[model samples]
Target chain A: MTPNERLSINQATIKYAPLREALRVTADAGITSIGLWRDSVEAASLPEAARLLADSGLRFSSLCRGGFFTVPEGRARRAAMDDNRRAIEETAQLAAAGAAGSAAVLVMVAGGIPQGSKDLAGARAMVQDALGELAADAQAAGVTLALEPLHPMYASDRAVISTLKQALDLASPFSSSVVGVVVDTFHVWWDPELFEQVARAGAEGRIASYQVCDWKTPLAADVLLSRHYPGDGVIDFAAITHAVKAAGYAGDIEVELFNQDIWDTPSADAIARTIEGFEANVALHLGSLSGDARP
Target chain B: MTPNERLSINQATIKYAPLREALRVTADAGITSIGLWRDSVEAASLPEAARLLADSGLRFSSLCRGGFFTVPEGRARRAAMDDNRRAIEETAQLAAAGAAGSAAVLVMVAGGIPQGSKDLAGARAMVQDALGELAADAQAAGVTLALEPLHPMYASDRAVISTLKQALDLASPFSSSVVGVVVDTFHVWWDPELFEQVARAGAEGRIASYQVCDWKTPLAADVLLSRHYPGDGVIDFAAITHAVKAAGYAGDIEVELFNQDIWDTPSADAIARTIEGFEANVALHLGSLSGDARP
Candidate 1:
């Protein structure tokens, strides 16, 4: 793996920090790539935020979102699609400015149920329709839409795509080159088919990006943001990573943690710790696989 | 579905109540069938508990559980298997006396990480091995082993099988009639393949039992019990039920809730409200599907 296949930090890691500070901290920690969530980008003025990434010499791996299309007909549906269109435009703008790299993808979190409807299948259909429209926009802009399958627990209020296989199936009809998957370990580690899906995504060149974080048990719902760093939880990251590698996916391995505990720590400490955790996790993983290869 | 195929109450809904009180409340609520947890059965001696079930004339849908095979090899493994064997014997004893029906399966919640083991695959293998042993015993007793696939969030410590597909796959190698699956809505509602798996389970004659409850967003881990009653949350229960029906499943639809809030309320009220919620949910769901059907 080359430096290009190294780590990217999701801005949500230090969501409390100003975007500029987060970028500087990421760069200082020697991670040259970053994933910027849409909410944070929206919080900042686009052009100004674009300048920060440019000046910092950081690669935007993905523009963090564009999908919440599970809305009832009429105003809600139109409004969601309209908002998504704006998000696509923003992603394109970031890519043009080198903030979001030319190769950077637009990450999507498929929305949950439409209010007043328990028809999850209908909502899923709406997501597919919304994705089709967004994919068209993304294609025109040379941006790949990376569908992130959230944890199943969030199927109701968050992303409806809760498994990598499900996400790939949803994106299958679309051109895999333009619409792909974001394999986030935190969200998918519990999936029994994680390795198979990761391999499948990689085989089709549909692995838009790879993200890592640990899954803690006895998790608090309110600690929605609290994630253990990679190697600190029960997930078999090494096996999944090996599967991804076996599939020939050579892309940036991003460390995107949404943890209140990690966020409350100093930015310097958090970024430094993340980098170390990444190194340790990968090293331990490789060592275990290679029968005594050690860092 | 006949009265024989009507709803059963899983006593874990009133797990907080004393066994006698729980039985009384369930019988008074006109729930002719009820399931009891292992701890609750032990709390009230097995013979006494059998007598109570006999007196109330409520059939046991399933024995609440008997599986922790993931524990590392040693005394713990021996103990878990032994305990499960005892549970099977108890289930048989109850069946022989006509306290529970001959078809009452033992629902298995496969245990999570054993102490000092990070090998999820290994733990899963251990679970399979344990089930292999228990399956023979269950067959001898004429009781089926219902593999209950829990929500992925509980994958680490509660159940490794987090999807219906995974559960069905695990039980497939065994005789479909001997080893089966319990389709609990709370555990499987978030599953994208819920409908497909239900059809498969029913087609294979592996639908040992069907359970229903709702998944509350912003789930609390401690009072981890489900708070969302049927129709109170986002799951499309009607579609799932309809699919099961179409697939030739004619088993009791068990109402199993574990809400702390509901438990604190009057047990009688909880049972009544649960039944009402079930009816309302069925009506609302059927009405929605029919489109022209009025309230």
Candidate 2:
């Protein structure tokens, strides 16, 4: 029943599960780690959710998200910033409640262009400004703000940050531990500069979280749900995994799928499939475990 | 009925139009130029298509396509190269038979990663090899091999070349006139490096064509047909059009809509809408026509 030591199941892969059920199913599947979504954590009340995670003994890999800071200056923008501050505190607390290897990393999706706006550069600038405002809070809370670059297809309404190089550039001004980047395979597999950016991110000490999922096209009617289990798509997992490993990203690899079909499967079945996919497609290229996993 | 002198209707915008109808509809709409698709041209017989275009007194903007060179070296690969050679010859003849401002440019869409293979880098290298093999023939035939960078969404199944920088790098190995690039707004409007790369393409003297279309969400079930008319979506045409103009490109600006709804419209009605969209969204930013249009 032992899964790959570095495997972490992002809760979104099992969308319908309540926080306690998600933790129990992941633990019972022999998976030692989980990435929590803010909705489930909030729904259960953070204190109770934290207790459930502690009892499950699953290491906390990362928080599902915290950055939608593309709003223009106003009450809405202020509210978004305040929410992010709360997320940082939640990330810190969740990591404290999990097993020894838990990472206090909050994945950030710099939101799409502010509604009714076509100023992409301006939206991106807002992200940088938001980071400047939030970095000190994140640092104080000991939470890493991990910026994720979504695929370009979602650039207008979901995320304007669309390349690893762009994400790295945005993170350049802050300390690596305070502000870093997420290398999600689903979002960045198409980037021409991926390997080079992976190396550059490593050199700059900005690789905060590494998430994996496969990309098969004829994307879902909702392009957001187009992710698949690894080894199920055309993505070259071996080449990308080798690059990430070479770049010294020695941490839990989270599988965060958004596909409706995968979400419909039972939570334990989904986790089992994720383990099989990771072991067959990604774990083989990861070399040895590097002593980073907690029992 | 006088359209912007620089405006051109790419034949695929009206996918069902035969060569004669496409030419007649475009000229009747007062559009001075048209980009022809190879299939329609072949349908009319290249010679007859050229005669129809010349009779319509429309300038030849460019040929619809020429490259799909991601196959492994074998009979299929050899067949693809031969087909590209024929495309070059057709481009030369069509440009020769058109009005004075005709451009002998053959748009090249580098094929996707070969089926069942995940070697993206290898597929890209094959594009380079294909271009090298055909550059001499293109140069001799006076055809500009316009390497087009489709959106990253199409990287796995349509075109491996998904960025202007990548296309430019591939074209750098040959003369700018022999190997050039297409600046299709629908494909590249999301690129973070777009403006910088547009300036680079201009500086390199490698911009062979400039195509415009818009992007909106709730993309079609078939993503290939997701393109919209210029003003129909969120792209900042003023900014991008200005960038292209500032890059010193004075060629015909082609409006190539691939949306199913647009294709379903009567051809003349579609061209009419394209003119309106371009005039409102792109033309104003284009500044004064640079004496490049023919009467």
lDDT of candidate 1 over A69-157, digit per residue (tens): 78877987898888877877887777666543435588888888766677777788887888877777778877788899998878888
lDDT of 1 by residue, B34-78 (tens): 877888888888998888777777777788788877887789789
Candidate 2: lDDT over CA atoms?
0.92
Lowest summed lDDT over 10 consecutive residues: which window, candidate 1 chain B? B286-295
TM-score of 1: 0.93
- Predictions in order: lDDT: 0.77, 0.92
TM-score of each: 0.93, 0.97
Candidate 2 CAPRI-style tier: medium
Looking at model 2 chain A, report the run of 10 residues with the lowest lDDT sum. A286-295
Query: TM-score for model 2?
Result: 0.97
User: Across residues B95-184, which tens digit of lDDT does each residue of candidate 2 receive?
Assistant: 999999999999999999998998899999999999889989998999999999999999999999999999999999899989999999
DockQ value of candidate 1: 0.52
